[model samples]
Target: MTAKPTLAVVGATGAVGAVLLQILSQRADIWGEIRLIASPRSAGRKLAVRGAEVEVTALSEDAFAGVDVALFEVPDEVAAAWAPVAVARGAVVVDNSAAFRLDPDVPLVVPEVNAHTVRTRPRGIVANPHCTTLTMIVALGALHAEFGLRELVVSSYQAVSGAGRAGVAALRAQLSLVAGTELGTGPGDVRRAVGDDTGPFPEPVALNVVPWAGSLREDGWSSEEMTVRDETRKILGLPRLPVAVTCVRVPVVTTHSLTVHARFQGEVSVDGAREILATAPGVVLCDDPAAGEFPTPADVVGTDPTWVGRVRRALDDPAALELFVCGDNLRKGAALNTAQIAELIAAEPA
Candidate 1:
């Protein structure tokens, strides 16, 4: 048998990094050495992976030496700077950031949808799609494979954890302040309770929904919304696919839910879509209206697969189908996808 490859987990101390560690532990052990790399402050910390404690080394040029594959869960800037370093040091990088998702030389990968794109990476880096895109793409990909997707209109109900640890902390703090109080009914009531600590969000995310996620882009479009459009098209190999998106930040902790209005090339039936979703890899169909069975963030959190529900053909348009989908943003949205891509690279014959 070929020698097992060495693996490096960059940003091994962040929120997604923590979840990645758990996933690495639970999955099949395909690596020989699992090297943990974090920032300087986190260098000495020992994190558990594959049932063993591994000391985190601070991010540096030498850290990628002798590593076959490196999984990166750092910020865009950090990834933009360090991913290339890892690649230069002979490590194939699977980065979970927005840094290289749009790079023509790099492949934006979702294992269930675009696994074949992994081998064509000329930049030696595979980019993971946005969490919002990942939440719905698997189910959409399955339906598209059958009916041929033409257009997409999606609205995401994102969780606080999508913004990282500070977002989660902000929601908890705001909830604690407004828990026993008679707020949220009057004007500026929740704001008064939340004070100035909105964390990464522009407005109070407790007892509120902000119709914004990423920074402002052209024509009032948010970066998050544009990411959904661009990444979806890139992953599905549809360059001119019409995609309109509106991203909202909700009060949930981990899971992200989206209401997708997909229009196919031809008439689509609810039964057909349901069958595709139910049997598709990495998708779980839970659509039963009369019994009040639908995937919700609370129930979908900590799960791996995309939980899809509310499957119905549009009443007015035979070409359109409306569905609700949920996924743990930190799991399939980030770490698991990165890990899956790395595993794909590992599976290649040396």
Candidate 2:
């Protein structure tokens, strides 16, 4: 029998990192030993896994030694600095940040929609796209293949957790303020009452939605917005595919949801699109308006698959379809997807 593969998780004490470890525990059959790596600040931190405290070690080139798969959830700078070293030390790196998603040699993958790209990682670094894009593509990729997606217009309602633990805190704090918990107001009011809290964001994240995420780059588009356009095009291999996206931060704790409208080259009836989505892998059909069964972040948190609901056809556009999708940003959007990629890569012949 083949020995189980060794795995290392970078940023193992972080929000996504924590979930990644939990996922590995839940999917324990695929792994042998688990190594948790983090920055020096987290080196002494002990993360409890399966009722055992695993000491977090400082991530370095040596951390990758003898590891078969390294899943990174650190900041872009750390992943950018250390992933190559990890690869040099012989580990297949499945990165969860935006660091290499658009890199020419690295493949941007969402396993359900673009698992083939995960296998094309010649440099041993496969990038997980932004959570919003991952959830959108899994739902849209099915329809794109069947009806020929011509154009896509997407708006995202991203959970605070996507920004990491701090983002979640800000939202909770805001809701606390909103509930008049401590200061007779909600969490957003607290931030506003004391200037602003910049833990997860530069500005207050309570009761308000921020249109911007990531740093502002040249041409006035923030990195998050550009990722939606660039990464989606690269993964789809359609640089000219007309796609427009607006990513926003919402008060939801987990599960990044999307409202997508796609115009297909060929006419696709609402029933036809529904049929396709119902049978797609990694996709759960929740589109029942009459029964009030629609996908929502509250309903999809902790779930494995992307959920789609509220399917409708535009009265004026015969070739267009509209739908809402909810996917656990931490699971399918990050950790679980990366883990699935590691499992798939292991299946390939060396």
Candidate 3:
């Protein structure tokens, strides 16, 4: 029998990395060796995986030795610097960072939407899309497949965890401050109570919504908003597809939710779109307003599939449909997608 491939998980101690370890433990074990790697400070830490504990090694060129696949869950700068090193060491890199997502040579992949693009990676790197895009793309891809998507208008209700541990910490701290008090009744009251320590967010995220996520970009668009627009177009192979997005940071601890307005070619039917989303791989349709069943972050957190609901045809435009989608940003948005891509590569003949 052929020997199983060795896999390396970079940033093994991070938030997404933690979830990745859980996913690896839950999924079928196809790896002969799973190496845990993190920053120098996190080295020597042992993390659980596949019913065993693996010690994390510090990030370095030597860590990629004999590894067949390397999954990166580090910051964009870390990935930007080390991914090529992994490639040089003869490892296929599946990076979950914005560093290579838009590189014309590096394929931005969401397995359910564009699995075929994985084989065309000239840089030996596959990029996972931003959490906002991943939160909605699976359902959109399903509809686009049948109806031919033309344009998209999206507004995101992103979880605090999407900003990493710091964001989660900030929200919890602020929530504690405002939990039993009448703080939000007056203007600037929550801000005064939460103080200037908003962690990664611009304003207090608890008991409030900040209409910003990433750094400011050109034309008043945030980096994250543009990310959803650009990554969606790329993943769907629609280079010029019109996409408008507004990303807001919500107090939720996990899972990202988005309201999507997708305009497709020709007339569309609510029944037809519902059927498409209901049967789409990596998607779950939960539309039923009468039963109070629609995708929400609280219900969708900790799940793998993108949960979609509120499926309806636009009243004014027969060519458009509006829907809501939710997905665990840390899972399908990061770890799960990376794991799926690595599995796809692992299944290929060596």
Best-fitting candidate, scored by lDDT? 1
Clashing pairs in 1: none
- With a 3 Å backbone cut-off (N, CA, C), the pairs that clash in candidate 2 are 173-187, 174-187, 174-188, 177-185, 177-186, 177-187, 178-186, 178-187
**In order, what lDDT does every prediction score?**
0.94, 0.83, 0.93
**What global local distance difference test value does model 2 have?**
0.83
Residue 144's lDDT within candidate 1 is 94
Q: What are the models' TM-scores? A: 0.99, 0.93, 0.98
Model 1 root mean square deviation, Cα atoms:
0.9
Per-residue lDDT tens digits for candidate 2, residues 228-251, read: 888778877778989888888776
Candidate 3 C-alpha lDDT tens digits along 284-334: 999899999998888888999999988888989999999989999999988
Worst 10 residues of 3 by lDDT: 1-10
Worst 10 residues of 2 by lDDT: 180-189
Name the regions of candidate 2 deviating beyond 4 angstroms. Answer: 50-52, 181-191
Better of 2 and 3 by TM-score: 3
